[model samples]
Target chain A: MTTPPETTTASTAPAPVLAPPRGTRLTLRDASIGRQGTPVLEGLALDIAPGEILTVVGPSGCGKSTLLRTLAGLLPPLAGEVDRDGIPITGPDAERALIFQDDALLPWRTLRANVELPLAIKGVGRRERRARAEGWLERVGLDGHGARLPHRVSGGQRQRVQLARALAGEPRAVLMDEPFGALDAQTRAGMQQLLAEVLRGTGATVVFVTHDVDEALFLGDRVALLGTGTGRVPHVLDVPRPRDRTAHDDPATVELRRTVLTSLGT
Target chain B: MTVRHLLRLLSLVAALGLWQLLTAFDVSVWLRFEQFPTVVDVAREFGERVGSEAYWQDLTDSLSRIVTGFVLAAVAGVAAGTAIARSRLAADLLGPVLEVLRPIPAIALVPVAILLFPSNEQGIVFITFTAAFFPVMVSTRHAVRALTPVWEEAVRTMGGGRWRVLGSVVLPGALPGILGGLSVGIGVSWICVISAEMISGEYGVGYRTWQDYTVVDYPGVLVGMVTIGALGWLTSTAVEVLGRRVTRWLPRTESRAEAPAPRRSPSWGRSLAGAADPGPLTSTKEA
Candidate 1:
């Protein structure tokens, strides 16, 4: 069932006054991704339209992370290719950003500096990059914490810093590998809500990988459930409107959550 | 002021007291207790020589050799280690040679060093370099290899090329290990420089100790020993302080743990600082 990508209004936070540039379409062409000659995901074909959030849910070893890494161009596919805007992804590019679970903020940099890394790598001018980094940090609710080291902040706060870093580059696509997995449930919920708010009108396509079904349904326009036995995605559940937490308690979402849970076998 | 400090002072006093009693009472004629200098005599000699120009010259000579050798070893070791860890070609070419050379003690190479270099100073410096090089190299390699793959991947995914990845991720990620190597290298370099001086060259703390031994100047030997120990302590302290400064972004707790109160210095504490990733020869290499 086709749904309008941009027309869905948020039931919680108000949409941003001006929408950011929409993300480029990302597609996998019969891609087979793996580690060291062993295929983890084989013969997979999926299209992620621009300006949408796609969440991947699977059991621990079902290669959810492998799938994200492949998209980020960090890992080579075993058989096929991942393409962005119809061009093969040769390697990592500035247009796509990956958010790691460990909040891989350079242990040598302050929060502002970590957020500034991608811009610096892109050869952005000093003052402009710093301003953008600061803006992103403030948007992520880390206004005064920019000078703090990553280790000095809590796991939830570090996750926010990571999100700021990912978005600061104004990437067309963001691949998150359990970005909030290390945080507690309360913090995870808060981060998920914040993510939904900040990303609502930004139009940056996001592929979020998580084992939690509720998180998958709450934040994704489509929830992709990967079966343990099959290396490919078995199901992609579309929600009428994502970013609607009240929908989470509705009978329809509850049934969909059950379906995702059954697919995950937990 | 602290219990630890009190215990350390008491331990030192007890050691000196035992030595003084042994010499005073002449506990065993066969043990050469009579030939041993008393604590008071050694202390007086230490006091007398502490301000002497000859002692100062020896101190400067030894300090210069250790600092030069240690700095050279640190720079070369980190470069070589990065190359070896990051490139298969470098590892293949240099790995076996370094492995073979690493085991031979720098002291054992003193004669060979003298033959190879133009002057005794260069020869002594060469020995110290050899002593410092292996530990720094091995530790840095371990640090580089043990770096979390995510750090590099993060940089790469952000459009950082090879050199950017090396500068942004590899160097900083490997720093704790490099610092570990430096601290150990400084200590080892001191040992080697002094030993090389005593064995081959002139005008160093080790040489002075050896000279005193030859001339049967017993108290003078103690003075030289104390001087060498203090110099080694100061140099290692400087390295540790620098290490802490460079890694300031680390959590306060982790950084604070790296530099413990120098008074209660335990060998394992140093190892603990670098224990996040245990290199192959971590335990044995420090010596």
Candidate 2:
């Protein structure tokens, strides 16, 4: 296995074309979902690879969020099975952690406690949870603000804490639901940078959901564009060469953007 | 605070003094006949009323009933709000029933309470409870329902469960509205408690007020009304203050107004001007 360089800080290199590793992290087999008893996404089949970052971006109302919810087991598949490491997700299993678009930290709880929530649920003792949660806080650039409530932090900082919360749980994968949509352009960029930096080494497969074209390109290893609400498969985009996209936008990155927009019928 | 506010206040005082003067000097026969007891008569009665154990006991009775009913309503209201928000079936099942009962006045429940409960005291408490219950329930439901789906999904994505998400995300986001409801509910509860006592009881501020009115103790009646007013005013203020305290995590003006806005120099000078900061004169001398 040729591991990508730890520091993706290089100015230029071949774009990383991420593929599903032989070991499947999550498999959506003909999974379908609906609201008000109407089908949204139909018979979807996809394999999210271990240790890879996959993103879902598409036009409005195209079931991008629904797809994330389905994988996280927030919704039951109307048709088929969603298996995780050969085990089916029953309902909101802790093995796969989901991050919300807004920072969902209990306003009463400080940053550290919010990050440590999953551990608390698992009944991990106070000391170990605090140490790990603190480490993840620093990783997300919230080292000194652990005692601060969610309201005390900036939006971008709050999202970083949300990220730390998802990562701190040591789940098999991290699911995100347009976590940066609410942030301003500058903050969104900063959060994107924070995510890429923090999730770099962790082997947790991150399945990020967003409708923003630029964002998916900025952070995703492989991008899947959910078809317009008409129910279409978003042909996955293999991130173009010059693997280190942290610093600049390469040709494939721009083409990939055009492809996603076109796929969403924008 | 403004010219309008000052004008409004001056006009109010002027009107009161004018009315008092008219009553003192004997204006119109009908107006004079219907006039409120003199301020002096009301004051003396108020003092005499306060010194009595009966008045104190009535006040205590009404107050304890309100506190109990309000506490019950708050807890039950929050739980119902959460349940209705989370479970669609629960909302559908219970919503219509609550809606059906909500419009029936709590005072109207007196007869029903008498039939159902062992005593009039419980019935009065029940009336107070009913008055508070609907306000809190409606507020909580709407608060929970009005929440942005993005907020819940946001927490769920961040590794929160059904219970955790409700406790951490839904409740806090719904707090501002919930507090609004509690304030309104508490005020309404006090109003209902006095009214309940008035119609259904032998002892209470309301009953005493009615008793004084029956015998034409107009001064005492005026005193009873004033007592109810003061009690209501104090309790409402306390609820508002307590609600504010519990939700201190909310963005109070204190957070924004006290925020250290960007400045080249310390506004220490401004805060210290007749304020409690260290003395600038002392600092300068030390420097």
Which predicted model would earn the best lDDT?
1
**Poorest 10 consecutive residues of model 1 chain B by lDDT?**
B278-287
Regions of model 1 farther than 4 Å from truth? A1-22, A125-127, A230-234, A258-266, B1-11, B17-28, B252-287
lDDT of 1 by residue, A4-30 (tens): 556424332234536534686788878
| DockQ versus reference, model 2 | 0.14
Query: For candidate 1, lDDT tens digit of each residue in B34-72?
Result: 777888999999988977889888889888988888888
Candidate with maximal DockQ: 1
Docking class of 2: incorrect
- Who wins the TM-score comparison? 1
lDDT score, candidate 1, position A249? 75
Clash pairs, model 1 backbone:
none
